[model samples]
Target: MRFIKFFFIVLGFSFLQSCSNPSLYQSKHYVFGTIVDISIYGEDEKKAEKVTKAVLEEFTRLHNSLHAWEKSDLTDLNESISKNKPYKNASSELIEIIKNARELERASNHLFNPAIGELINYWGFHQNEFNSMHPNQLKIKNLVARGPSLDQLHISGSTIKSTNPHVKIDLGGYAKGYALDQASKIIHEHHIKNALINIGGNIMAIGQHGNKPWRVGIQDPRGAQAIAKVDLLDGWAIGTSGDYQRYFINDGKRYCHLIHPFTGYPVQGVYSATVLIEPSQNAGTLSDVLSKPLFISKKEDRKDIAKKLRIYHYLIIEDKHISMTKAMADKIQFLNPNTQKNNQIEITL
Candidate 1:
C-alpha cells in the first residue's frame, strides 16, 4: 500500500493454479510495511488455506509488535532509550531478533546498521504515507556525527539499553525474513510441502511446484518487468534491495531509504541489489539483511564485501549497467538476451 519494494513475479505458478486443481492455493496480504504473498502447491485446499491463514496471523503479529515508529515493543524500547532508561518490557522473541540484528550489523561493519533509525525518522520515513521532502542538511550531519551504532546497545537478558541516546532501533531490515522463518516453521509443523512465503520481495520456497523447481522473476528496478528469472530451490531464499522501494527525487537526485550511517544520507550510485542465499539456519534472514550492504557499498568493493560475507551468488543494478557474480549469472536466465543492452555487463568470479 505504501512503497513498491523489490518485488518479484512468480512465472508459471498461475498456469499451474488455473488448471482447476485443488492442489494449488495462494493468498496475498498487506503486512510488514509491504505486500506478502503465500503460495502452497500440492496441498488440499482446506489444508493450504489453513496453513496460509496461520502464516498471515504470524505476519500480523510480527508487524504489530516490531513496527519501529508505532506503539510497539520497538517503540517502547526506543522511548526508554531516549529517556536514558533500561527497557525490560520487550518480549523474548523481540530480544532474540534484536540480538540477531546486532550480530548482522556488526558483520556488515555496521553498514547495515538499524541503530540509525533516528536519522531514518528525521528523513520523514517513519510516516505511513511518504511525500517528497528534503531533510535538513545540518540535522543529517549532526545525526551522522553522533554515530549511534547498534554495538552501543547493551542487551542483558530482557533489558536493552543504549549508550548513545540517538540509538534507535529499526528492525525493518530483518523483520520480514524473521517472519519467513516463522512461516516456514508453521508450514513444516503442519506437514505441508511445496510452499512459497514471500514478504515484500524476500522469498523462501519449499519442496517444489509439482515436479519442477519454483521459478521467481527478479523485478527490474527501472522498469515494469523482471530482468531475469531463477529457479527458487527448496530451503533456499532470494531478496533484493532497490532504491525504488522508498525515496524521493530532489534536484534530480534520488534520495532513498538505504542510508549511510557515516554520511547520514541516502546511498546513491547503485540502483538495486539482489542476493541468493543457500539453505541455512538463517537463510531467510541473510537474504533479507545482506542486500542492503551490497546496495550501499561502492561498486569496486562488491567482490570484497561478498567475500567477507561469504555470499556466493549476487547481482547489483547500477545507474549505468549491472554487475553480478558469475555464479549468479549462471543461475539466472535473463528475460531478454540483451538486458540493459545499452550499458555494460560486468561479471566477476
Candidate 2:
C-alpha cells in the first residue's frame, strides 16, 4: 500500500565551527514520501551536488516504479496477480528486487512479509494521512485465512505470475534499504571519499567525515532528544523500526503499520527496535529488513530469530524496559544515564 513512515532513529552529526566548511556539502530532498538527506565530505560542492542529483534521480525512479498502491509497475504486477495473468516483459530491476525481498522474507521466518499489502490497505495505511480508524476484524480474519505469501509468486526471467489471487506485493518494508544500496553504489562510482545517505530514517555511511567516523543518534521513543549515540564506520548501515511512526491510537490501543502476517493486527508492547549492519554484500538491505522481525517477534522468540539471522547488534525497548545484545551495549553510549540505571537492561545472548 501507499505508506508513510517517519524516522525511527534521531540522527546527529558533528560539524566544524567554520561557517563555510567547503570540504562538506549537504542537501535535503523530499522523496519516498519522506525527507531524504545527502551529505558528502572531502568533496567539492559542485561535484557533491552533481553526485547528489544523480542519487536523487535514482531515488525518484525507484519511488515511481515501486509505489505500492499508486499507479506503478508494482501495482501493475498486483493487478496481474489478482487475475492470474503473467507479466512477460517485466523489468529486470523489479524482478531482482522481488527475488531479493523474497529471500529476506524467508530469512525472517516470514515475519518480514511484503505480500500482504491488502491487509495493510485494510488498516488505512495506504493513505497519506490516516483517519485513525480500527481495521475491520472480519476483513482481517478473511485475509489472514487466505494467507498470501511471497512464495505464491513465481518468477523466471522476465515472466512473473502469481498462483494466489490474494497476494498483493508491497515493498515498503524493503525499498529504503534497496535505495540506500543503490545510492552507495552511485557515490562509490563517483569516487567520493565519504558520504551519508538518509532515506527517512534508514542511514548508510561511506568512509569517514574528515578524520573521524560519522556519528548518529537513536531517538527516544517518547521525546525529541536522543537516547543513545553510535559511531558508523565505512560501509555500515543502520535503521530502526518503531511504533512511534505511522501509527494510530484508538480505544486506548496503538495500531501501527507493522502488521503481523499471522495475526493480521498491529504488533504491540515494543516501542522500537534498532539494527546495525556491518559492511557486507547487502548491508543496507539487512539494516532495513532485520529490525522488523525483532519488532514483530515475541520476547521469547527473539533470541532464536536473531541467531537465525546472525544479528549480533540490536536494541529493543518494550514498554518501559530496555534490552540489547552485549555487542550493542558496548557500541552505544546511552545519552540518558537514568535510563541505564533505573532499568534492568537485559543483555541477550
Clashes of 1: 0
Task: Please tell me which predicted candidate would have the highest lDDT against the true structure.
Answer: 2
lDDT of 1 by residue, 1-349 (tens): 2354546878874534645756668788899778888988887788888888888888888888999998887898899999999998668988888888888888887889989888889877887787667678897888899989878888887788888888988888888888888888999999987998888889999999888898899998888888899999999999989888888777777788888888888887887899999998789989999998898877777788889888899999876688999999899988887685866889999
Which lDDT tens digits does candidate 2 get at residues 1-349?
A: 1234465343444453323677878888998878998889988778989999999999999999999988999999999888889978999999998998898889889999999998998988886777678567898899999989888888888999988999998888889998999999999999997998888889999998788888888878777777888988899999999887788878777888889999999998888999988998688888989999999998899999999999999999876699999999888998878987766789976
Error of 2 at 328 (Å): 1.0
* Candidate 1 Cα deviation (angstroms), residue 247: 1.7
Residue 97 of model 2, lDDT score = 89
The parts of candidate 2 lying over 4 Å away from their true place are: 1-5, 8-13, 16-20
Residue runs of model 1 more than 4 Å from their true location after superposition = 1-6, 13-19
Worst 10 residues of 2 by lDDT: 10-19
Query: Model 1: which residue pairs collide?
Result: none
